[model samples]
Target: MKLIKGTLVALTCAAMLMGCESKKKETSSIDVKDAEVSKNLVLDLSVDKVKNTLGTLKEADSFPRNITKGQKDWNLVGVRDWCSGFWPGVLWYAYELSDDPEIKAGAEKFTAPLKEIAYTPADNHDVGFMVYCSYGNGYRLTGNEEYKTVMLAAADTLATLYNPKVGTILSWPVMVDKIGYNTIIDNMMNLELLFWAAKNGGDKSLYDIADSHAQKSMEHLVRPDYSIYHVALFDEKTGEFTKGITHQGYADESMWARGQGWGIYGFALSYRETGKEEYLDTSIKLADHFIERLPEDGVPYWDFDDPKIPNAPKDASAASLVACGMLELADQVKDNALKVKYTQAAKDLMAKLESKAYFSGDTNQALLLHSTGHLPHNSEIDVPIIYADYYFMEALVRLKKLEDKIAMQ
Candidate 1:
């Protein structure tokens, strides 16, 4: 469980990247709050909400997924569920914020069942979601060797889905027959696992695989306007990109808010890992588009192109994810204007997320409300999703660190 000094330094550097102070220039129209109360209050409230939800789970196998309309309880799922990691991740973040033993115990309990996922090669690309968010954060915070072993195995299992010819990991094996080769914007979030593995005694090629995937995604999934396609199809045999499409968006051409959030966060993290200018550029472009498209409150509708407009369901999840991504992007960008812009955009988004309009409060156990999962399928519409809460807490933690860094300076 003991980390060498090098690994500790790497971890510290990563945290510093997420927590770096923005330039003092006030370029944003949005007023950035300076009070410590605003920062700590939201985080404190989130810890209480997550701890309360943890008390409600009676079954060892159950993990909170979402709360349906008019439903009082979380729709629980098993360890195999893609979202299962977020609840444990939420627990880890809560523990990080409070250093509370009860939350740590709950985090370990929820995270333990997911270790099985590492040993098994997944039929889909979401083993990163199932393992990395749980064991990855666990290992990051606690330096647990068992967690590290699970993450390395999970990363190797995830690597099995990579197609050398296609230059990206296959996102959904179930859809390969129908879609040729499929990669989604969400898969970008999984590359951190491979990058971490490559650095931590796994094959060096794991880094190459992740780097190649990010490059291919940039070439195929990102549009001229820097908006993203939810899915990109390629020839499995020939490794040629066939088409761009959508599975969850309002249309193939419309920007799905959450998918765009994934691109921003994914590319930002990729740039963080590889120090590639192109990746950083892509993240900044996507972020600019997202910021320009947001409503006055800073949260976005489920789809920018959704005909409903003001009537379209607001995706607090998208806002949460983008807020976290923007914080990362803020740290990576050298331009002081961009740094302030992204940092303020993140702050505004978090402000809206913490407001009475978005925060779940006593209305539910989930941290944020009104996340649209897959509207085309009429599923999880305007519900409280676990990943929203996970990223919301993550953004808070990052923002808090930024504040602390500024204070120390």
Candidate 2:
């Protein structure tokens, strides 16, 4: 895969994690103007790609999930599907970057259907994913009062699943009988909704709920080596720790790439909202492990211990999530060396993602390709998944903000 010469050199330095101060200085000398031009070009292309994908949809209520093998269009899902919010989130990001009227209208059209999810009592913890990602971003960008109302109600609905005994949100209520009170690493991502609601006239206790969940996740989900388990089980009656297991990963002992991504992003976000040093430390540790284990290309395999090694399917979704997470982590870090390390790592991952190897480029309606979702279920493997595109676009937006900040400096 081709990468910019400067980016390639910086990535090589980052990968070695040794004495490369001179190399880092040299790569840092690249012109800010050139970086801005490249970033804007990618953002424009992403906006166009989102618009094109909207054209392919026959129903306004349908959401793009993934494009399966041999399929030219997206596999559509209903509003209740776990992935339903990502497409609208993608459109919101596209509009944020481009400010195009057509993209804004599309974002509104798609985000409207998700309002039902806010009021509906959900048995699962994905209400945050289903509502916050769509309406949260919409409310942020547009300040629509209706969007705010829907998000508050969704936050309330999500609060119902938080088990006080477990000190965490129950991720899958249906699985509680079979596996006890199960909380996946992915649930950490949903805490942002609760955090937001507590600040936005919903309920003050929502913040405590989110904080408790993050604290509990840090206590149980993170391993000693900083690698994260996909699922952490707790006894329903006493809230005692049961065990850590895997649902979508290669094995119970393996570090699932996306699960690690969730931990990195979730803790970084928790640190951002609460200014907890332990959360920042956890994010850094998880990020360090993730970066150290990455393949030569900077993107990661679906699972670190999948045993397929050189032949494993790549998960661009995980890379996208980590890129955004590392960028956020960089913003919050006071250590110059660690900040520079994370910033460079994020750039390296984004460079790899923008390459011809991963960018969809008219091959499909999505922005990215080769994301593995539920590989054990034989589902959505090596496909262009919607969340990958959403986070990829969000990472670009974050990168652009960083560049603008540097240019001003």
Candidate 2 on 267-326: residue-level lDDT in tens? 999999999999999999999999999988778999989888889899999999999999
- Would you list the clashing residue pairs of candidate 1? none
TM-score of decoy 1: 0.90
Candidate 1 residue 133 Cα shift, in angstroms, is 0.8
Model 1, 47-109: lDDT tens per residue?
A: 766787889897767899999888777999998888989989999998887788888999999
List per-candidate RMSD values in Å. Answer: 9.4, 8.2
Query: Total clashing residue pairs per candidate?
Result: 0, 0
Give the Cα lDDT of each candidate. 0.86, 0.87
Candidate 2: RMSD to truth:
8.2
In model 2, the worst 10-residue window by lDDT is: 25-34
- The positional error of residue 290 in candidate 1, measured at the CA in angstroms, is 0.8
